[model samples]
Target: MATTHHTNETPTDVASNGTAPTSTVSPETLLDYYRQMVEVRLFEEAATRGFRQGKVGGYLHVYIGQEALARGFLDAFRKGDKTITAYRDHAHVLFQGGDPKATMAELYGKGTGLVKGKGGSMHLFDVENGMWGGYGIVGAHIPLGVGMAYSEAYRETGNIIQLYLGDGAIHNGYFHESANLAGLWGKDGMCPCLFIIENNQYGMGTSVERATANTNLGSKFDSYAIPWEKVDAMDLEAVIAVAHKAVDYVRETGKPYAVEAMTYRLGPHGAADFLEQYRSKDEVREARKRDPIGLLEQRLLDLGVTDEEAMEKIRAHAKELADEAVKFAEESPEPDLSELTTDVYAPETGLI
Candidate 1:
């Protein structure tokens, strides 16, 4: 795939496959991003502990190192925008204004969870927040997201859909199908969708180089003629800057766009992935130096946006919030067995 490089332009002026120059973002905004990352990190850490204690059932995937990707891109979302992603979605839900207690409760298999304890770790859905839901199957949600983009275009809603998937998902046939349709529909300037690829280096144990012939994931969109870009997910500002450009391109052109966020997951693929035979501990340790949360915190401090005391206070608050969520999850009640068949279908009376 051919890559395009753009220079001497502001973030808003830049096109796809190019880095955008960071502008004067407000201190409060930067701090809020830092706080969100901290909260997610704390929540994931608590979730790890919860899994260890057997409080959470099913598989556990924590977004320890990829907080910036969610925080930065989600911040670019506008009203009526819809989002969908694969199973590694707790962080996405939380960043989309999901209740921490409800999220944790869902993991605990309680009724108070986002999906009433049924979805568990993978299928978190909060329609009110425009988070369509997370899919357990690899690449399954790609078509669903494209459908959403079609609906928005058909209804003339002027709303875009932000679809997220991992590096591994790009290999699925459904992803290609959706991308091809998005490119086709976008020809009329109506399929506004931002396909975000969270390239965390490894797709559950298999590295990108080992799985695909082309390691440049963004270039995959080139086959569909969709404009693509890549950004350093470790840098919060860079993510935000590039994300704004991507989102704007979709909104302005009423077309599809792609952004490949170069990042790494500090933890194993899942809680049960203890063997970790594919990668070494030293690789993870070295990657920790570029930790998104830590990088944002240091940026905040260096910019005089906040001091160590303030950061410590934020950390404590985040930890307290996570602890409170755990307590709420523990006290929450489980769904009754009767509910199993209730929401499975529409009312017998049919639509009103």
Candidate 2:
């Protein structure tokens, strides 16, 4: 997949993927929601800086503009709730309460990383946060999330699993298989999972319109009789509200729900892919007009958050934390090669 990179743009364009529009939320909620978005943005910027300075290694995907949707879902997630996603998973890790330093160290392939540096930028895990490691294979992790939901239900834990997939995964065979199973189990009150589609308008630079025969990704869940809706990814408050509702619905009904978040990537799939031919700079600039962080920031200001100094302090603090994460990663030790032979098999390994 071709990737594109662009400079940050102000006043990003905001759009909704749903058929019906949602009502407005309070300003106080908006401010808190924006805070989450800002944290994600600052963290990504710091990660990018780390990558350029060689403090971080491997393929890096920065979730700068799409922070609102991810953070919103995190805010809605309950304790012991689970989350899973693909290679583009840094933001998801942070939202799941994984230590930022550990994640940075993982990117640098340091043993202090979340997965003991065994998994680089693509694989982040913090089981305590109910977050499984990011899977490299497209759509492969969907079944894991579904199975987790099944187990949670069987154990009567009342926990919900949030399964995230990129626009590209929707076309994969695993996607259909997982969704069908999720729907079947959900109908019988055996599944407690939320299927979240982070449709950033591109599947590795291929516009959703160009690649999808059924561009209405949210409605596709109807075939399985699973309830679903689309949310405006650019608005943090909107996302939080929608996510809260969805989470509540799934928890109460013990069913699976799908939410399509309409957003833009605003960066290449990774640092290596120079996105040029796929999307124009002007198009990126237009999308930037609806940048989620900026939108939420303005909403906070409108909500009587007159403390400019405090806001600056928050941003600065986030940047400092990111810097510390980079330092930790740089100083952390690498994984020993000898340990690779260990943890290779479970107690009941069918084969030696």
Candidate 3:
């Protein structure tokens, strides 16, 4: 009989040293991480409110429980690197140094928003900050992200693409085709892309267990010859530790890698998914116990690095920032009628 003794251990946990990792996050970094997580939490909450208030149009998918995934993975992000993901992309943009006001304004469909409100909530792009854009179609961006990495490899630019996709995409043809090409090109050291699978346990309402035959998402990379691993994404420190190594591996080898971030989404899939028959309330309450912000706060207290008063202050400031972003979105003006045809195509040319 096969026996697994460490089923409860996080992927980043030391193999020989119990469940506690040997590495320690600095007090300064811990505090900053807290600020980032809280801000995302508040900002996403505000966005949800806006959606309910009928301010936002199109599909709305906020990154509520997935903030730690962005906070940790993007910590390894270097200048010139590119990031592309699906619709739930606000957190990635903000963590990539995107402006909160602009992001929120986009959700509100204002002209001053990112992409000038042309690409609402689902398509926020800030190329200067290394974020390609949030795509709406499932598994569709896989090929595009791979192509971007191939471009970087061809130019010898030493830049990689952090291609983020949900677990659901792995079951589709888009992932298979794109990953196969990435593997073949990577053999020639021509594809430097890190595939981050944010496995939030559900693809819409269908759980991974019900969808996947093997259920080990990372091992799917083996079929395409890509090395892969899993990370405890809810633990921000753990994720950052593993992310640095993975980021370095792709950069040095100019090859593809995959990371299945084992995390859970603490909120409904979208604003309208009220009857969450897919999961129970008890399941959600238990997951909340491992909330990244809450975990970090407890860790800080255990280390005596920060007091409760200071933690409250940080949270207060996060709320202030969230309030400011919402206000900015509310005050911003909608795109004018002329915008309908302005960004639809390339400029007119004499020869054409």
Candidate 4:
């Protein structure tokens, strides 16, 4: 069953209350999650280098500290499940089974890119893989995600939408309107949309505390009568425990649910954000202690699932994969001149 909170429950309630059951994932699964995290870390680090060297263009929002949220939640994703998120979305697509080379090529604006180089870093689309393109606009995709979920509900597809958004978007008009419709449709057990709020503390340079009067993004869902809770996204186990329940609940009941993943953006908002004047260095330093990859490593060590040698090997392999992706992106060809007229709209049809 989907874990539920009392009426108007704040994010702090679940963060302190242990509303989600403790994770009982096997050691083997934990190790796999750790491997994925390592791969993501290496991939993001490479992306940062690419952005700095001018190989990657447009805004580069690497998911450094916030890997576990996507890593853990997506572990529970079914084959037909759909994911939509904001611009900080490379991790989402990667975790959703997207090809690393194609994703990097997209960032490089190569013709071999995921969306044929039409969409840059902020617009990756792999519909065949269920990643429905990341939006460059804040709150812009909320209505679209909701509409998609409603479509599934109407068609009885037995599928759901993993609609991800940042804390900043919760205050936007689109969020409120779409959430209202989700709640209304959910009353009939129809809209199976799992709202995963990736609250990484900051929406660009503005901190969540400064951006909203009510800092508990989860509680905002209460207004629409949607069951919501918060999880410490820094721990993979904690995230898995909650995400499994939430995904199962949404799938079984065909209703909307929300999980506010409390996480931090370890890196600057984007690669171009060289001088993060808003936050202190000490804060970022402290947040590093809770790095999901580090935390997962510690747990793996505790359980004797892996040791230093294995971890080192994993790191090396991940780095090699990242390097290969970079090379592919660099060598890939740019969009052809004829591409300008293609993919502008659906192909015309004749009914005669």
- Candidate 2 residue runs with Cα over 4 Å from true position: 1-33, 347-352
Single out the weakest 10-residue window by summed lDDT for candidate 3. Answer: 1-10
lDDT digits (tens) for residues 25-139 of candidate 2: 4555455545555666777777787777777777888787788888777666767788999888988887666788888888888888888877788888878877786888888
**How many pairs collide in each candidate, listed in order?**
1, 9, 0, 0
How does candidate 3 fare on TM-score? 0.92
lDDT of 1 by residue, 1-352 (tens): 0011112123355334443557445667788778877888999999989999999989999998999998788767776898999999998888888889999999999999999988899999988878888899999899999889988988988888999999999898999999999999999987899999999998899999998999999999999999898889888888877777888888878899999999999988998888899998899999999999888888888889899899999899999999999999999989888768666667784433
| Model 4 worst lDDT window (10 residues) | 1-10
lDDT of 1: 0.86
**Prediction 4 TM-score vs. true:** 0.93
Clashing pairs in model 4, backbone N/Cα/C closer than 3 A = none
lDDT of 4 at 303: 95
Order by lDDT, highest first: 4, 1, 3, 2
TM-score of each: 0.94, 0.88, 0.92, 0.93
Q: At residue 203, give the lDDT of candidate 3.
A: 94
Instruction: Give the best candidate by TM-score.
Output: 1
Candidates in order have lDDT scores of 0.86, 0.78, 0.85, 0.86
User: Relative to the unseen true structure, what is the Cα RMSD of model 4?
Assistant: 5.9
